[model samples]
Target: MLSLICFQSLITLSQIWLLAVMSILWIIWKSRNDVKFNNFVISVQRAIGTVMAWIREGGLLIKAPMGNSILDVQILHSLHLKGIPRRSTKVIPVFWHPPIADWIKVNTDGLSKGNPSIAASGGGLRNYRGFVKGFFGLRLSIQTAFFVELKGVILEVSFAWEKGWHSL
Candidate 1:
């Protein structure tokens, strides 16, 4: 019984270690691809931190301390030696403002499935108090996102005009 328990524990520990290693490698690959294709470069520390968090979130390393993986710790130490910031926590919030007293604000949006696949456009008109005056949505045939977006604007404008909302 003791030998069986020991074997199971060893297997579990190895699995966790394997997951940790794979997580780091996967993150590096993804970050490399992002830099290559999107021109988005992330700091070494950020990449390690992201993978650490991802592994933790996936419950793969539940017993390990956050950001305490051996590889991540090593990379983080190197980044610190290079005087890079430990982490960047930048959050920008969006706030909506009401229209002026007599004017109604119209907001529109377009969504495409596969860049040039099925699409839809819709919009709503809101008063200064944020009350919805009218809203609409429609399915469209395959089209570019830009075209759908333009269609959304045109639809909103036509709707507002028909509703005698010229001040918007």
Candidate 2:
């Protein structure tokens, strides 16, 4: 149960870090006058949509017809037993309550740590407002963070559309 809390805290840091990178990326986007950010954003968004659709079509969920939700739980348990980041148990909390139709609330975050080069971002979507939804925490290279963040936004928007909610 507490592992979930640690996971959330890491995601928060990942969000802050991603924002900083996005600000820097703004400069990169500005350097190229012939190109627009929409190109990158759009490509990633399309990719995410396709991947999610694939998940649904292929039944990729744990104990759920669409996907294997328990895979993440198992991975987390493995990491915990292996003492990965053995000290991430201390993380500050942030309160959030997102609105969704048909009882959905999500909490997302980004996480990056120096040692062992871990960078991940994920969240949970819940029906009961207080329950956890889905989570993803991955060890990443610095360059991958950009890709991951982009996918994160893409996944977010795509999920909203799939749920017939307004994300715009």
Candidate 3:
């Protein structure tokens, strides 16, 4: 049955067809796992509902241009899936203040995929006029968010000391 659905998707080449086939397979796998591990059997109707929800959510990620393909529109309409919502165009202005004269400002930041995951640290030194003096970025192994943030500051301080810009 799965092979037949995949074969049909190959023939049609419709985005909806591919989405539906993948969603159906995912629902089946999830249902099987639930029954095997948790002794929970989901109803057929519930499984079908989950597939439909997945299809709708996946449809939003499709990047088809508007009104370009009638077949795409028909498929979406038939599935009762709405197009992606448009984002607001509002913009907010931001201003940055420079450091006092004869002093250097150090800015640092860090990011991690999760609380403790692959992380990166970066920092820059700017003079009173907001001119960049030095900058550094480091890709680190698995680390906590706090550790990465502190690492960025440490790197910035060490870099400034090496450059003889001690008035930070």
Worst 10 residues of 1 by lDDT: 79-88
1 or 2, which is superior by TM-score? 1
37-86, model 1: which lDDT tens digit per residue?
99999898998788667655544333433232344445434433211223
Give the C-alpha miss distance for residue 92 in model 2, angstroms. 6.4
lDDT winner between candidates 1 and 2: 1
lDDT of 2 by residue, 44-139 (tens): 455445544443332222121111234434533432311123233468999766465466664556555543345666655665445554444544
Residue-by-residue lDDT tens digits, candidate 3, 90-157: 89998878889989999999999899999999989999998999998999999999999999999999
Off by over 4 Å in 3: 1-93
> In lDDT terms, which candidate is top?
3
Clash tally, candidates in order: 0, 16, 0
**Angstrom error at residue 12, model 3:** 19
Residue runs of model 2 more than 4 Å from their true location after superposition: 1-103, 114-118, 144-150, 163-168
Which order, best to worst by TM-score?
3, 1, 2
Residue 155 alpha-carbon offset, candidate 2, angstroms:
2.6
